[model samples]
Target: MKKIIICLAFSMLTWHSFAQDIPVKITKSELFKDEYKNSNIVLVEDDGSGGVVIVRSYAGGIFSSGYGYYFEHYDSNLKLLKEYEYQSKVKKEDKKIYRSILGVIMNGKEINMIEYIYDKKLQSVTFNALTSNINDFDFTSKELFNMNSKDAESGNSGKDRDAGAQMIINEDKTAFAITVDIKDKNSETHKIYLFDKALNQKIDHTFKRDIKDRKFIYENIDVSKDGNTLYLLGKVKTDEAKKKKDGGRYQYELTRITSTDEKTQVFDTDEHYAASLKTIIFQDRLTCIGFYSDRNDSRFKGISYFELDPNSLAIKKSKFNPFTEQFMIDKYGKDKDKELKNLRFKQLIITPQNEIILNAEEYYEVYTHVMTQNGGGYDRWTYHYDDIVSAKINSDGAIVWARNINKRQDTSVYGNPFFSYTSTAKGADAYFFINTGEKVRKIRKDRIEFKEASPKRSNLTVIRINENGDFDYREVLDDEENEVPFMVAYGELTGDSVFFLGQKGKKKQLLKLTL
Candidate 1:
C-alpha cells in the first residue's frame, strides 16, 4: 500500500549509506501457450502457504471472447500448481456493458473477488463478490448491492475498459468506499457507499449541492481509521469569466460524510490557487496537501499543506511553502521560461517521525498527423511521462528538502504500460525502480539527469535516496542478461518484497525483489 520513491539532483550529496547491493531475484515461468499468449496479470498475492496466486485476464486474446480470466496458483519456486479459466456472464445483443474489478482479498480458505457491474436489462449497477476456494477452486457468487443506473455514468467505451466508478480502500484494508456521479439537470449528484472488507454494507447516502452555479468534479477519497467517516476532494468549477479577472476558474472543496450528516469546506485563498489536492490522516488528524500556483497559470509555484478539523472539515493550520532555489535549478537548468506543470500525484508516504514524503510525475499529451503513402493522413497521439518530483515535509508543515529527477519518455500506446516507475520505502529512505538505458550524469552544479531509455532493451535501475536527501543509483537487471522487460509501473509492494510480471510476446515471467 505504501508506494513511493525519491530522486536527487543536488551535486554535493553523498552516495548510498548501505554497504551492500539490495537483494533481487528473477523467476521465469514456463512459456504461456499460444492460445493465452496475450494475457496480462490483473492480480497477484501471496497464498499464505509458501506459494502465490496470480490472476491473468485473457479478455482480448485470440481464443477468448473478451471476458475470460485465468487464475493461477504457483509454489514458492514459481512452478505452476493449478489454474482455472473463468468467464463472466455477458450478452452481445443491443446493450451497453460495464465491469471493473474493485479488489480481491482472502476470506478463510477462499478468495473473494469484488467487481462493479452494470446491468443493462435491469437498468442499474451492482456490486458482486465471486468467491473461489483455494484448494478445489469451487466458485460461488453473491450480490452485494444493486442500485439504480438510469442516469449513472458508465465506463464501457470498449471491451476490457474500466467503468466510470472509483473505489478507495483504507490503510488496513478493513473497509472501502465507492463513489459514483449521476447526471442531473444542470450539475451532478454524488452517491457514496461504504462497506466492510467482508462485503457488508455500512452506509449508503447521496449528496446534492452547488447545482445552481457550479459542478463538483470528484478527484480523491479517503476513510477514517475506524471507517466511520469519509472524505471527498473535488474541483469546483465556476464561471469561465472568472479566469480573466482572478486567473482561476476552479476552486477546491473538501466534503466530509457520516451516517447522519454531510459537511463541505471550500479552500479559497486570495493570493494563490490550488493545483492539486489529496487527503490523508496522519498523527490522528485529517490533513490535505498538494501543489499550488501563484497565478492560475498551469505552472506550479510550491507545495501546500493544511491540517483540518476532523469533524468540521475546516482548516486549522495551513502553510504554502515555495519551492527552493536549488529545486528550480535542478529542473530547468538555466531556462527562465520553463516551469513545472502537469504533475499528477503518485505516492504519499508518512514516516515514523511524522514526516510526509510527496511524490509526483509530469504527464501530458500531444497530437500530430502521420501521413500514409496515398497522401492521406491520420491523427497520431503521444503520451509523455517526463519528470519526477519528491519532497519531505516535517510535522510543522515545513518543507525540509525537495528534489527533481529528469527524464523523457513518450509512447503512442494506450497503456503507456511500461514507462513509469514503481517505489517502496526503506525506513526514512526511499527506493525507485525504473527502466533506463542512458548513464546517470550531472548536467549542472545542481542538476542530475536520468536519460530516457528504450523500454524493450533497457536496464532496470534502482535509485536510492537516503534520509538526508543524498542519493545513488545501481542497475539490478542488465538488459543484456535479462530478456524480458518488466512492467515496472504495475509492480506490487508486499512487506519487504516487490512482485512484478514480465512478458514478451508468448514468453512471461515473474520477478521478485527482496529489499
Candidate 2:
C-alpha cells in the first residue's frame, strides 16, 4: 500500500471564485499510483457530513471473472482519510459477458458496498448480489437468483430482456426492489420482488395487466418512509396506428405494492406525448413530472406535472402545459414554433426561497455506418450534447424565469456522450460547469454557435446565472495555459462547494472548486 497522494497546485486554491476562493486539492488513488492498466473500473459516490464516500471496483473486461473493489473516505478538502480494499470471490471464468454495478451505502456505523453481477441469457437472467462491509473489510453476503425475461421458451423470440433486470436498494438498507418484465407462459407480464436488509425475499408478486400490444419501460422505484410499502413507476408503449390518427403514446403507470396486495393505476396523456416520466417522492406524497410533445413525436413542446397519493395512486391535482416559451432558437438560425427539441430534464431542485428550479439540456443521437467488404457494417451512434436550460418556477406551477446556458459539444466515439454539463445552486442563484472546445467562439447572451473541439483543447467554463435570468461566463480551467483537466461537469455540488474528477493533461485527481 502506498500513501497515494500527488500534490498539484492551482493558481488559487482558496475558494476559487469571486465570493471566496475554494481550496482545491487532488487525491490519487492506489490504482493510479500503481498504474494498473488491466483494470475495468466502476465508481459509486455519496456525500456525507464528514466527507464523500466512494466505492470503486476494478476488474478485467467481459472476459475476466474477478473483481477488486475498495472503499475510500475523503474529507472536505478531498483528502483521503481512510481506505479499505475489498476482496471478491467471483473469479470463475464462464466465458460470458457479465455486467457489474457498484453502489455506496451508509448503514448505521458501517459502510456497505453492493455489487451486482448479472448476465442475460436467452430466456432467463442470472443475477448475483454481492455485499461487503467496508468498516470490517470483509464479505457479508453473496446471493444468486434466476428470473424470466424475453420469450425464450416459445422459440427464443421476442426481445432478449433481462428477466430480473431492474433493481433498487433503498438508501437506509431497509428494503430492496426488483422489477422485471418477461413473457411468462406466452403472456407479457411483470414481476416485483421485495427483499429485506439481509437480502431475503420478503414479497414476490406478478403484475396482472393486459399489455400484449404494449412494451413496458421501467422508470423509477421508491420505498415508503415507514418501510411498509414499495412503489414502481413506468410507461407502456405501442406501435403507430394511423387510422385513428394515433401515432401511439406511452401510457403512464404507477404501481403500489404492499406485503399483501398491490394497486396499479394506468393512465394516458390526453393529447401530448411524454418524453420521459420521472417520479419524485416526498414525505407526504409523490409527484411525477415530464416534458411533452404535440403528438407522438419525441420533441418537447411543453411541461407536464402532477402530484398523486402514494397509497391510492390517485391524482390530487394535475397541471398541463405548464411551461412558458423559453429563450431558445432552433438550429436553423430562427426561433421555432415551440421549445427546442432534445431538451431532457434533470432532477428538480428546491431552493431556500421555496422555488422549484428545473434544469434541462439539449441532447440527441445520430446513427451512422461504415462501408466494408461485407457491404455495410452495423449502425454506430454519435451523441451531441448542446445548450442547457435552468428555469425558476413558483409554487403555483408557473414559470418565473428561464435561463439558457449556451454550448455545443461533439465526439466521434460512441457511449461517451462526448461532453457533460451540470449545475449547482446557492440561495436563488445557480452556477454551471460546462465543457467546451478550446477554440469555441464566444456565445452571445441570446445566441450560440456550434464548433468542434480541437484534440486536447477542451476547457471547463464556470457560468453563474442570477435570479433575473442573467448569466456571466468565466473560463476558469484552460488546458492550454495550465494542466486544467478537461472534465469539470462530473463534480458533485454541495452548498457553495463543488467537487469532481479531473485530469490535468494526463494526471488524474479529485478537484474541489468553491463557488
Candidate 3:
C-alpha cells in the first residue's frame, strides 16, 4: 500500500492509493424529502473539532412550506445532533419568498448562512440569516441594495427573482462580504457589501461601468483574503474592432474595485485571440490565464498567463505563454495547422512549492445526423474530449513539465458533467475522477483514440499525478455493462480519505474511501 498525503492550508489529510483491490465503504444517506424534491438546499463545511455539522433547510416554511425557515444539524456519522425552526410568531398568508445565497461563514462553532431577501416593490433587497449557536440561531434581516429589475411590470425584483448573490468570508472569520451581480444583456453591474466580524457593514459599494460600445462581461471576482479589495476578471466585447488590429472581437479585461478608487485594465496582444479568461488568487497575488487562438478563431492554439497584485493593480509578471514549443510538437506533431486546437481549460492547480499545473482536455463540437420522430434530422451538439494534458509551470514562471492521461471519448448524450473530470490536489500529487470508455491502448497520431464499442460504457476512473509529474491510472468503480447510471462527483479530501456524495436517480449515496 502506498500512502498518499495532502497538505492543505487549513488542514491535512492522508490516504492510500494502492493498485490492488481497495475496499470502499459506501453509506447511502437519503436526504430527499417530499418538498426537497426541488433540491434547493444548503451544505455547510464541518468545523472538524467534535462532530461534523450538516445543515438541511427549506426555502418556504418548515412543515407545510409556507413561511420562515427550517434547520437540522447532523453529526459526522449522519446522526441527528439537533434541529430548529425559525418563523414569525404571527404567521401570515403562505406567500412565496425570493432569496439567494451570499455565502456561508464559520465563526467559532457557528455556521452563518448569509442570504438576501428580494422584494420587487421595494428599492432594495433584504439580507439576513446568522447562526451564533445551534439553539440561539439569530435571525437578522435588512434591505441591503436597490436596483432596477429586468421586468418593470412586477414592481418588485420579481417575486421569484434570485440575482445570484455570492458570499465570501475570511479565514479568521473576522470579516465577511456579500456580492451580487446584475447582468443586462451583455453588460453587468456588481453590488458588493463588506462586513466586520460582528456583522456590521464596513463598506458598501456598487461597481457599474461601461466601456464605450464594449460591454463589460464579468468572469470570476475574488475578494482578497484580508477582505479589503476585490479583483474582477472580465472581457470587453466589441464587434467594430478593425480586423487588421483586433484578432476576433474581445479584449482581456480586469477591474480592481475598492472604496476610494476603481481601476480597469486591459490586456492587449495586437491580434491574439482569447477565450475563457479566469482568475485564481494564491498567496496575495492573482493569476489570470486562458487559451490563445488565432485571429477570428476560438480554437486554442496556445496558452497565456500573467500574475498581478490585487492591492496595487501592478503586473508582477509580464504576460507569458508558458506553452513551450517542444510541448506542441510532442503532442500535435510539426503540422501547425493540424495542431491541437479546441483545448478546453478545465482547471488551474497551484502547489505549495509555487508549482502551477494547468489541466485541459481536447474538446470540440461536431454536427451529425440523428433519428427524430419525423425523419433523419441534422442536429448540432458538442463532441467532448480526448486526452487530458497537464502542464506544470515552475516557481520562476518557467515551463517545468507537462504530462497527460490519454483518453479518447465522447458521450452519446450532451453536457459537460458527462465529459469533464473533477480533481483534488494534495501536496505535489493531484487526483482526478472521470468516466472513461474501455481501456486506452497505444496509438500514433496527433492525439490518442479509444477503440469502438457496441454500447459506450462509463467506468469511474481515478488518475493520480505524482510530484515528479508521473501519471497513474486506475478504474475505481466499473459500470462496463451500463447497468448503473454514471456517477459524477467532486469529493472532499478529508483525513486519510475522501468523502463523496454521489447522486443515483433521486437518492444520494455517500462513500468513504480509505486508502
- Give each model's clash number: 0, 7, 8
lDDT of each candidate versus the true structure: 0.72, 0.58, 0.56
Q: Is candidate 2 or candidate 3 better by lDDT?
A: 2
Distance from true location, Cα of 502 in model 2, Å: 2.5
Alpha carbon deviation, residue 487, candidate 1 (Å): 0.6
- Residues 412-440, candidate 1, lDDT per residue (tens digit)? 88665578888777678777788887576
lDDT of 2 by residue, 1-515 (tens): 33344554322433345343322332322213322222222333444465666654566456654566656676654566777766544535644434444344454445544444434544455455555554455556555456543432221245534344566666345666666555554345666677665566777777655655236666677766555678777676644322335424557788888889988887666666776766765556677777777755567666667678777888876666534444543233344575457787654676777667778878788888867897867777778777776777655556677655666776665434226566777788777776666554655444554354543556666677678877666666666744434344445554566655544333445555665
Residue range 1-515, candidate 3, lDDT tens digits: 11112221221123334573333333323332223322222444555554444443334445544333445455555444565655433234313445555555555666666766555445445677555565456655544444554422132344223245667665345676776655544335567777765566767777776553135555666666666766777776655443445475666678877777888777654577776666766666777776676654556665667777766667777554535554554466533453356777676777778677788877777777677888767665746567677777765555676655666656555653345665656677766767766665656654443432222246666677777765666666566423332334344444444554443344333334434
Query: For all the candidates, what are their Cα RMSDs to the real structure?
Result: 6.7, 5.1, 7.6
Summing lDDT over every window of 10 consecutive residues in candidate 1, give the lowest-scoring window. 1-10
TM-score of each: 0.86, 0.77, 0.73
Clashing pairs for model 3 are 14-496, 16-515, 102-167, 120-155, 120-156, 120-157, 121-156, 124-145
Candidate 1 overall Cα lDDT vs. reference? 0.72
TM-score of 1: 0.86
